[model samples]
Target chain A: MSCLDTIADYGLRSIGIGERVLPRGDGIGLCEQFTLIGSGLIWNVYFGALALLFGFVFATALALAKASPRAALRKPAEWFVFVFRGSPLFIQFFVTYEALVLLPQGGLHLGGLTIPTGWVTSAWSGALFVLFLNTSAYAAEIFYGALRAVPKGDLEAADAYGLTGWARFRRVVWPTMLRLAWPAYTNEAIFLFHATTLVFFSSFPAYQQRGDALYYAKYFADKTFDPFIPYPIAAFYFVLVTLTIIGIFGVINRRLNRHLPQAARPRLRIRPQLIR
Target chain B: MFLSCADPSALSGLNWLICYLTTDKQLMFYGSFLVVLLLLVVVAPVALAFGFGGALAARSGFWPLRMLGKTYTAMVRGIPDVIFFLFVPIALDQGLEYMRHKVLCPDWTAPIRQGNDFLVCPAAKLPPTDASPFYQESYGFVLAVIAFAIVFGAFAANVISGAMNAVPRAQLETAEAYGMTPGQVRRRVLIPQMWTYALPGLSNLWMILIKATPLLYMLGIEDIVYWARELGATKSKIYAYPHPDWRLWYFLGLLVFYLLLTRVSEVVLKRLSARLARGQATMAGEALRKVGA
Candidate 1:
């Protein structure tokens, strides 16, 4: 079969579009591999993007809470970060899924209402929640470090100008913290994106065998008994997306550092070792 | 493991719990934690050696060697490590078997890869198929360790190379001026001074390596995750210990174990960093000198 035909059939297969079922039986084509795996990229983008978008605000709050002087506020925040950061994310998914599964199978009881607990065991909800918390912890640590490293002079300037409390934080402290944090935060973001590939591999079973890029890649590898092709294809897709992440974050990093002199601005260096 | 606890069906309360935890499989489960620790201990020095070699290669005067070294460090940057974790072992296994097949089965004419099957001669099979289960399991484990070492060696090379560069040029120059050979300068000055700079990155890598141990489950090795899942599943009444799904509890135990490991490692790494920092020209060393004075 032509590559275009394969693309037409399997292009949106990951989202259950085009082909109603995945290709099977003898001799799976290159086009099927590319198209189905490419289709799987959709779920990866979904998990990474949504988790990161939601995790950012939570992380910001968490970082501030961790940096807060009040012990009550600080202690929980610190514990949350430590718990999530200290453990393997793979275990987190397993534990969360198992815990969610043990919730009353008939759903939660409320006054004249029932909250469905069954969905919590599915990848869409449970895995995403795990990813959300995991990224929040990592990003929170990065942000907390930047919060501490924010120039003392910047806060002093804000104080000297009589900007206090919320106004001071908004006008001076927050932006500077973000600017300082952007580089390491970029690394965290990239790692979190890479981590989303683990969702289906953990406890959360991919309903209907629908899964992320790595899942389909593993599927093809299993079928073909050829690790050479499918795995590298997945790796290629990941590298492309990783580069795109760097590009997008690079633009944001430039914007964050724009007010500073070029020489003073911190460049986003790709520290490969920062990943978990 | 108490003598009275052998009959799990008769047990109840604390006795039942004791019997349940003392199963042979549970003992293996406990032993798997040591497997993780062993991987960390073994992989660290081996990966450090790989990293040192790569860093030195990247600094080599030879162009092809430098390119190979640069590629080693750069390849891990853009790809998800789990991909490598999955890929490296299988690829390495196939590669080794393919080489063996070439050497051992020259008379055979059938294709090594016939359709989806990787058909190597029996002699070429890793552990030779007739080998003991212990040998097979150990072979699988060693492959997993090598995968970890290779992937992490790239990260370590990145760290070590940066540390090598961070060592001031003037020190090397002074050594060179004293008529020291390039290798002698590297041994006497560059290598010794790079540790302080490398400590923070290496410590970070150690924490990362700790967190990555669970991926061994993916490689089909019976690591802690495997044991947790195996032990935690609900068993029927036909089994010795009938229970509802207790995976949550098992996982919770694993989580606490990891947290404790991370905390202990943090304390130890801090001390190591301080020790490495002594007499160095860095800020930490300066602070130590002030305290001593």
Candidate 2:
């Protein structure tokens, strides 16, 4: 069939939109691969975007908790970050899947409430939850470092200007911490999206053959027995997504550094956020 | 593991636990941890060697060689590393077989990419079709190691090259003015000084390497994850010490093992970093000098 036909049939295939059965055997072509894999890109974007959006709030709280002077608050946040960051994402997926299965098999025995837990094992929620926690841990570390590095003069100015407590944090501390953390946080965000590829590939089930871009890429590779084509195609889509992430984050980075002079603005560097 | 552990069915309570843990498969499961350690030990130095080569190539005056190194270092930036981990081993295996096919079956005329199959000659088959299982497994393992080395080598090269560049221009120029050759200066001044700059990045890489050892499972090596899944699955009435799915427990144990492993490494690397930082012209060294004074 033509590439247009392939796109029409498989464009929304990953979310169970257009086609059900994937092209197999001799019928698989480059058009089908591109369409299906691009379809799968939706799931990656779904997981990455949602996890990052939710993770930012938790990560900010985590950074604040970690930076808190109180031992009770600090210790738990510290341990949380340590546990999540210390293990490989691959193993975390495994452990989290297994725990999700076993932990709440029946229902929670609250005083009068019963909460079912089967939904936690599905790829959408379960994998997203894990990615959420994972990104929070890494981002919290980055933010914590930036929180520590917030300029002394900024805080002094806040104190002198009668900005105290929540107002002080909102006006002076939070913005500067974010400005300092933006570059590293941008790297963290990029890698967080990249880590979405690990979800279906790991323990979680992609019910109804619906999975992320890498899943479709691997499917094509396995079908064709040629790693050369599908992987590079997936890489191309990923590079596009990555460039988009850089562009979006660059805009935010510019906004964060807007108050400072151009020369003083710390340019975002896409270093390897290779730490688990 | 114990004299009385053979009759595991008769055991109960702590005894049953002990017997189950001491099973032959458990021993191999324990042995697989060493395979992980071996991968780390082997892959680190090899990757560092590859890194050094890439770093040198990046530092080269020639544009083509510089481009080659730049591309190698840049490969990991946009792409998910798992793609490389998956692709590299198969690609390397096929590449090797293709070369061997050219040499071993010079008279063969069939296309290598026949339809969906890679049609290498029988003689060019990896581990030879009739080879022992042990040989085949080891060959697969060596290929996995090489793949890890290649990808991580790029990461290390990025780190090392940045560290090389981070060494102040004044120091290198001072060496140049002292009549030191480029090679001599690199060996004496650049290499020695770069370590302090490289240590933080290298140490971070070391942790990443530790975490990535688990990806050995993806390459189909029967590492700890493989064993955890195998041993922790539900056992029926047919087996001694039958139990329900305990993979969660097995994985939790793995979590603790890794946490401890990383915690210990962090402590040791902290001490090592202090030693490396001594007498350097960096912040840590300056702090050391103040304390020493």
Candidate 3:
């Protein structure tokens, strides 16, 4: 078959859209590797994008709860963040997969509603859930730090204007917190993308041979006994994706800091440790 | 092992539980935890040393050595480190055998690469191809450690180089003005001061190193993950334990172990950070000063 035929066959293979079976043996090459791995990028995007969007709101609440004077609210948020952040993501994956398996084999039933527990075994569901909690804890920590660093003058201004409670927080406190936390949040975003590679590598089975980029790369490496080729292709793809993420976040960062003078705007330096 | 727990098949209730927990294989499963810890303690310093040498060489006056060091450091940056974890052991093994083949069988003349096979002289074979299982296992573990050290060392070099730059130029200038040589200044002042700046990066790297330990399973080492899978699988009635699939519980136990490790490290590191902050000129030190006031 032609290269286009191969692409057509495996292009959406990750989501079970096209080919029913994976190509075997020397069937792998630059074309097959690029096409299939790119297909698997769908899962990565789905997990990263959705987890980030949802984690944003949850993290904000977590930050607020952590900063609250009420011990009931503050303590739970603190422990949640501590437990998630303190552990390695790899362990989290194993624990999650096993937990999902232990759930009643059939679908869960509640109040006459049948909830789908089958998909929980998937990388899309299982790994995404883990990544969601993991990022929430990390982002909550970042937001908490930013909340602490909200300038004393800003709070004083809110007090002087008699703007108490939600009014004060919405107008003054939240925006500044966002500005301070934006850079670290961007780091969290990149790390989430990198962490997506762990999805298939963990216990979550890549059903119907639908695996991520690293999975396909490893597949080729094992088959060809040549690590030099497929791995660099995967790396090149990741670097491109990483750079794209940086570019998009950099734009949001610009808008967030638009009120500042040109020199005062923070530059996004690539911090290596920013990714767990 | 409890002596009363001998009859695993006949026993029931808590007695059966005690017998199941004390099986010889279960003991080996527990032993893997120590192996993981040993790998971490052994690998971290070796990686740091490699990183130090790499960073120093990259900054060297000699052009070739500088290029080599720069390339070594940059090599790991572009690729997913998992690639290196998979590739390094095999590549190193083959590379060593190739060198030995070239040296030991100088009189023999044949291409080493023939189809899928990598042929080497019998004298050059690693573990002699008939070595004890212990030799084979130890050799594999050593190779894995070297691979981790090489990859993580590059990351450490990046951190160290930045930290070296973060140390104020004024300190070096003043040391020179005091009639100190470059080497002497580096040894006495720069090295001592650079650590305070490097501490944050180094600590972060240490955590990453801990997380990366799970990749040891991929390296063919029988790590905790391997044992978890082996011990946690469903056991049939024919077996002594005869338990349902408890792999999930085993994994949960592993998760808690990691969480505890990280929690303890955070507490210890916090104390270390406080110790490092003493009389230092930084934002944290400034906060400490205000607290004292």
Assess the local accuracy of residue B160 in candidate 3 as a C-alpha lDDT between 0 and 100. Answer: 86
Recovered share of real interface contacts in candidate 3: 0.39
Residues B99-121, candidate 1: write the lDDT tens digits.
Answer: 99999989988998877788898
- Identify the leading candidate in terms of DockQ: 1
Cα deviation of A232, candidate 2, in Å: 0.8
Tens-place lDDT digits, model 2, residues B242-286: 999999988888888888888888899999999998998889999
TM-score of chain B of each: 0.98, 0.98, 0.95
RMSD vs true structure, all candidates:
1.2, 1.3, 2.6
TM-score of model 2, chain A? 0.96
Structure candidate 3, residue pairs in collision: none
CA shift of A200, model 1, Å: 1.1
lDDT of 3 by residue, A141-207 (tens): 9999999999999999999999999999999999999999998888788778777887888898988
lDDT of 1: 0.90
The DockQ-based CAPRI class assigned to model 3 is acceptable
**TM-score on alpha carbons, each prediction:** 0.98, 0.98, 0.92
Which sections of candidate 2 miss by over 4 Å?
Answer: A103-114
